[model samples]
Target: MDQVTKIANRLADVGGVVAVCLGGSRARGTHTPDSDFDLGLYYRPPLDTSALRVLAAELTGGAVEVTEPGGWGAWVDGGGWLTVDGARIDWIYRDLDRVYRIWQQCKAGLFEVGTQAGHPLGVYSHSYAGEVAMGRILADPTNELAALQEQIQASYPQPLRDSLVAHARWEVPFTLSLARKGVTRGDAFYIAGCLFRVAGLLAHALHAQAGCWVLNEKGAVQAAGQLPTAPANFSARAHALFGALGATPDELATAINDADQLAADVLDNLSPG
Candidate 1:
């Protein structure tokens, strides 16, 4: 068996582990030769972290620490990092019940972005559903994960799409207004932060309009640029705006104006999905 398959089997054998799946760029078939494996481990409550830690150590031939549930955060849950056979593997834990609940929320057009360390733009609650929709099952003895994945892949919820687009559309201008204030004071740092938020929000709106699930902020703008609903030169303009940001009041003001124009273009181009 391949290394990933072997790893997934081992993970599935761990007590409380309901399913194991491949995630990230690898699962999406967009991975480069160097992309590390992102493995999702869906488990019930009272997970056997001790077993997981032992298994990780065995796989790596060294001591490894597995975080307890909620160790990473509420949304991210917990897991461990390991290098098996010289290949990096990330174990991301998901509470099965929580995943179901979150998926239901997405179907109902209700989602929230929560603070998470690794996710600079915050973790979207629908990301759990996205993960399942995008993941490739490696081991699912009970067929629960497969069934859930099928349900998620069947269709992109219209309510979820509308909710995401509406929220992002509202935030883009609100965030830009904050950046405008910073431009007058030549607060490049603050202005830059707000601009990044604007870009991210615009990406979110575009992805929603395209009925795509945005897993995170990484490459989100570029991904949105690929969508038919995206504004012309959306990613290029966003990149240029960021590249042109300057510390001077006049330069910052110009960047703000460009960003506002980009936002208007995106809003104008958006159509009902």
Candidate 2:
């Protein structure tokens, strides 16, 4: 068996593991040669982290620490990172019950964002649903994950889309307002941070407007640029705006204005007739 298949089988055999899935770029078919593998281990409560640690050690030929549930954070939960046969692999834990609950909440147009390491914009509650929607089931003996995936794939909830778009669009101006203050104080870093947040929010709005499930902020703006509802030259304009930032107050002000204009264009495109 291939290394991935072997790994998936071993993971499935671990106690409490309900399913194994291939997520991220690989599952989305957008991966390049160097893209790492993202394997999701969906489990019930009371997972066997010790067994997972043992498997990681055996595969990597070294000690690896696997976090207990919520070790990473509330939204991220916990998992491990490993290198097998020189290929990078990420094991992400997903609680089966939580995943389903989040999906139901999203269908009702309810979700929240929570702080999580490695996610500068925070983790979206609906992302749990997005991961399942975008992931491919590699091992689901009982078809548990498969059933959820089927339901998620059947349709992108209109309420969820409307909620995401409305919330993100509303944040754009609020975030820019903060950037405006930073610009007045000539705080380049603070201004830049606000601009990045605005960009992230705009990406969210664009993706939702297009009825796309964006998993995370990584490459999200460029990805949204490809969506049918995205404003013309969206990605290029965003990149240029970032590249144009300068240290001077005048320059910072110009950048903020440009960002606001870019945001306006996006919101305009999303506007109803």
Candidate 3:
């Protein structure tokens, strides 16, 4: 464990590397025995991943999963994955300029949600801000990470929260409306999709209210189920919403209404600390 931290500290010496930190479950101290080590490298524009790739190769002494800087497309364009001494380590690249801009926009009452490949549920721009602010700094020789944490950590701006809340409030009903329409058309697939989308939106809203930054939609349900405001037996409810074998139209409508009301109540009473 110390060696991994030591290696991460060394990565900060690379050019354009502003900070290197530990993130994800490990940083949050929520890691299980099998959880992967998430090493985040904060860099400004003109990032060079060669140093990372070379280091990974040196550590593994074999082929490693790495991409040339900017090769992986948006959201994550650099970094690599390595297994050092049987410990799984994932390197994630963060553009400090982009994260800073997103955090600034969040403070200015601006936020946007969109979906990307491999992230079917969705993503929010403000998520990056939270990660940067909440991450555990491992190497910050120039004090860049310290400065960023000062501006971003645990800072829940009202605009960002309100934006997400409003978005969820609208989306829940919008999808429910479509689901109702699907019943009329006997389109089970449409209803299923609507349910999935509404679940994700509700989960997103809950995370926002909890002052949690969500990077993807994959774990939204389980995470939301743990929130204080979330309904009891959320996993069961999710199953009922998504798992209905030849369910009648009326049953589907009931589920939709239940979700709608649950989402509304949660949004209305939200108070992020």
- Where does candidate 3 stray beyond 4 Å? 245-251, 271-273
Best by lDDT: 1
TM-scores for all candidates: the values are: 0.97, 0.95, 0.89
Runs off by more than 4 Å, candidate 1: none
Candidate 1: residue 210 lDDT (0-100): 77
**Descending-lDDT candidate ranking:** 1, 2, 3
Highest TM-score: give the candidate number. Answer: 1
Residues 69-186, candidate 1, lDDT per residue (tens digit)? 9899888888999988878899999999899999899899999999999898889898899999999899999999999999999998889888877887788889988888887678
RMSD of each predicted structure: 1.3, 1.6, 2.5
Going through the candidates in order, what is the number of backbone clashes in each? Answer: 0, 0, 0
Predicted candidate 2 versus true structure: per-residue lDDT over 1-273, tens digit per residue? 278877998899999899999999999999988898999999997899999999999999999879998888888888999999889998999999999999999889898989999999889888899999999888898998999999998988888878877876778889888888877678999998998888888888887777789888899989988998888888998887779799888999999898999999988778441
Error of 2 at 236 (Å): 1.3
